[model samples]
Target: MGLGGTAKKIQTLAEKAEQTYQRLNDLREEVEKTQETVTETGDRVRQLETEMAEQRAVLDAVAEEVGVDLEAVSTDAHITEAESDDEADDAGDDGSADTDGDDEAVDDDS
Candidate 1:
């Protein structure tokens, strides 16, 4: 090739390299922002867990004072929740339009 052709090829390669560098820089910035967001989310989650632990401690103390068996209550609550979920799933599977009032009444009685 002639010098002119060689110069054009070099210019195109340089432009491509510049474009690649810009893309890499943009990706790096996005990664940094994502890391910061993840860190902030992790901090919030840890804070929430700590608060929940504190609240649970207070709840246990109060339940003990009121002569309530916390473990039994917890187990009963889980069983009731599971039953409700199962009933809802069954209703959904049957494809029947069950009225909300009936469901609410059953839930209130339990």
Candidate 2:
């Protein structure tokens, strides 16, 4: 009787240990997947940041080509510029663009 009770206790202990090992493996897999996702997300964010910086550079270049201060392109400037454009359109004016002809002349001289 004593040997049978001891065998049952050992079997129960083995089952619990197996369950614990499976749980650990499951946790390890979850952690690995989480780490991979974090790495991919980090890479994507850096790519987006680089793209945004490039777009900002292009926007700045366009602003310079129009002879306007890119630094001053705030929300207020956007609103005012929009209104000014509407007025110009309504008045049928085409000669009030922000570009300076003298700047081109100076560039030609250089």
Candidate closest to the true structure, highest lDDT? 1
Q: Which digits, one per residue and each the tens of the lDDT, describe model 2 over residues 1-110?
A: 99999999999999999999999999999999999999999999999999999998998889889898665668778899999998986676343543674545544553
Off by over 4 Å in 1: 95-110
lDDT of 1 by residue, 18-72 (tens): 9999999999999999999999999999999999999999999999999999889
TM-score of each: 0.78, 0.64
lDDT of 2: 0.85
lDDT of each: 0.89, 0.85
Positional deviation of 97 in candidate 1, in angstroms? 16
Candidate 1 minimal-lDDT segment of 10 residues: 93-102
Candidate 1: TM-score?
Answer: 0.78
